[model samples]
Target chain A: MIVAQRKPFEEIMNMLKGYKKVLNVGCGTCVAVCLAGGEKEVTVLNTELDMARKLKDNPIKIDGITIERQCDREYLAELDSKVDDYEAVVSMACGVGVQFLAERFPQIPVYPMVDTSGLAANQAVGWYEERCRSCNQCVLGMTGGICPVTMCAKGIYNGPCGGTNNGSCEIDTEQPCAWFMIYERLERQGRLDNILELHAPVEWLDQTPRTLVQPGYKKVDPEDLV
Target chain B: MKSGSNLEKVLKAGHFAFTGELGPPRGTDAEEVRKKAAFLKGNVDAVNITDNQTAMVRMSSWAASLLIMQEGLEPNYQMVCRDRNRLAMQADILGASALGIRNMLCLSGDHQQFGDHPSAKGVFDIDSMQLIYMVKKMRDESKFLGGADIHEPPKMFIGAAANPFAEPFEWRVHRLAKKINAGVDFIQTQCIYNMDKFRKWVKQANDMGLTEKVYILAGVTPMKSIGMARYMKAKVPGMDVPDEIIKRLQGAGKGKVAAEGINIACEQIEEFKEMQGLAGVHLMAIEWEHKVPEIAEQAKVLPRPVIE
Candidate 1:
């Protein structure tokens, strides 16, 4: 899931300073699972922002609401009636959701209250660790299911560089060396030859903005209309 | 005659070669490189000019290599994968070759977090192994990594580093084999203090018949002080310093630690001379280049074999 952290309170407050009334929006998907932006978090932030504004000489009114996944257009329809009532919208969602909210209400200014970090796995409650980089090309089949693109610091194709110290990366002793783990796993599986297979340099797929059309959803040819 | 380099000539002539290291100064002082080169000019076959070693900013290695060449010493030009992509790497290879540099050492540099600029982004587009293969391809096949023909390709004696003492000890030999398969002509092991582990690793390489494929150089660094030894043992990643060496340094009597350090290095060189499948010793007198001549002389590797 995409993990995001809320922006500092001061930055969010500064963005809301000019507005007399604002809507605090939240997403109930990735951000909520990471504990950054959810229904409970939106209510808490709304109360905190209300109190903070009241203490300051300039006071403002703020409303809060959380909808289902904001990435989908259907769930975003729930905000149509209440969005125009406020002067501005502050989205407490991943970057994607924030952009979607902005697109949904073009008249009102949209500000992001959270910073999207990375695609991660929820290790435990309130703990998230990055597991994938969405690099488009996956090599887990050969790497013994370990993602070197995300785990290795250098992200090189052939690794366990001389900096592998005691099965840890040279950058940090605490961080396990991805290649070392891959080697150990492959060795145990009696597939050590996999490590010897040279991998060509990665051809980065994200060089330009990429749009994916699901196989079944691609537009039919115009010739069909004729 | 792969590169027609003096280091290559020495190894090819069946001589026990000796190489020294010269870390470029942090600032752009050409005299600093020349001054360090003076100490190693006649003492060793080639001097390895490090490329932003330890990830700290320094005068570029190619520039330092040219500076040392002016002093009549051959340079083993070192390039790391941390700072450049394939384009820059190949461009530098052509540029260095044009400048008459024949020896090149490829390394996956230290992480930027350990350097002055921790926030800097490292460009490890190609790791050391890939770098080796690329250099070899440019040299032998006269083709760039992307398969375009180079009008004039760089002919370099490619070298790569190996760390036998690093974790998953059994796999280190296989890693070296992989590097050898990548077209590396020489191997320089990481600094040695744990002799038992190194000997075992070398034996494994010999057993796998990897020693016959490439020249192997044993790395030796003279410990300047007890603090240096302790720091390397506890803090430096991938370095293995045995407890006995520390005890020996402590027993060197007050103020005599430096001399004892040289003695210990000399002793390691003596052992390397007798070891099978070993080609040479790479002396990394970090910040202590002045002592290399004495260390070489004491180790009886002096009057370095002058192959015609």
Candidate 2:
């Protein structure tokens, strides 16, 4: 899931200083499960902002709402009628959601309340660890299901560098060496030959902005309609 | 004559070779490199020029190698994968070759976190194994990594590092085999303080017949003090400094630590001379280059084999 953390309170407060009225929007997906930008978090942020602003001479009003997945257009359409009532929109969703909301409401200023970190697995109730880089090319099939792109400090292929010390990365003794784990897993499975094969340099498919279209769905060209 | 380099000739002639290391200055002081090279001249077969070792910025290995070459010493030009992509690596290889450098050591450099620039992004476009394969392609196949024909491909004596002391102890020898299969002509191991572990690792390689495919050079570094040994044991990655060596250094007492360190290094060199399947010793007198001559002389590897 796309893991994100709320931006520092001071930065968020500074972005909302000039506004007299604002709408705090939250997402019900990844951020919600991570306890970052869920419905309860929006209510808490709105109350704190209200109290903090009231303490100052310049007070502001905020309305909080949590929608089901802000990435989809259908969920976003529900905010169309009520969005114009606000002077600015504060999005507690991931970067993608903020951009989508801003695209829908072009007149109102949209500010991000959270920083999108990475695609991660929820290790525990409140802990998350990055598991994938979304590099568009996956080599997990050969790497014993451990993602070197996300695990190794250098993201090296072929094998462990000379920096593998006692099963930990050279960057930090606390971090496990990705290639060490790969070698051990492959050795256990009797597929050690997989690691022996040379892996070519990554193609960097994510170097440019990427857009995906489903196999059955073709992007319609406006020129064809014309 | 794959590279026709002095080191290659010495190893090919079945002579036990001796190589020394020269770390380029942190600044662009060519004289510092020459000064260090002076001690190694006629005392060692080749001098390894490190490239931003430990991720700290320093004079480039290519430039330092050329400087030492001007001092009439053969340079084992070292190249690390942490700072260059394929384009820069290929360009540097061609330039180094044009400058008359024959030996090149490929490595995956230390992580940038340990360097002066901790925030700098490391460009590991190719690992050490891939770098070896690429250099081999440029030399033997006369082709670039992209398969483009070169006008005059660099004929380098390809070298790679093997850390037999690192983790997954059983797999270290297998990793060496992988490097050999990648077309590495020579191997320089991590510094050996645990002789028993190193003996076992080398015996495994010898049993697998890997010693015949590639020349293995045992890496050795003299501990300047007891603190240095402890730092290497606790801090440095992949370093296997045994506690007994530290106890020995401490036993040397106050003012005699440096001499004791050199004495220990000389003893290791003596053992390396008799070890089967071991081709040579790469003495890395880090920051203490002046002592290399005495160490070589005491270890009885002096008057290095002159191959014509």
lDDT of 2 at B256: 100
lDDT tens per residue, model 1, A71-124: 878898899999989999999999999998898788989999988999999989
**What is the clash count for each candidate, in the order shown?**
0, 0
* Model 2, residue A195: C-alpha shift (Å): 1.5
Q: Grade the docking of candidate 1.
A: medium
For model 2, residues B98-183, the per-residue Cα lDDT tens digits are 99999999999998999999999899888898899999999999999998999998979999999988888888898899899889
**Positional deviation of A95 in candidate 2, in angstroms?**
2.1
Q: lDDT (CA) for every model shown?
A: 0.91, 0.92
Q: List the candidates' TM-scores in order.
A: 0.96, 0.95
Candidate 2 chain B lowest-lDDT run of ten: B165-174
Report the number of the highest-DockQ candidate. 2
What are the runs in model 1 whose C-alpha is more than 4 Å off?
Answer: A219-226
Summarize candidate 2's per-residue lDDT along A47-70 as a digit string, tens digits.
999999999978999999999988
Clashing pairs in 2: none
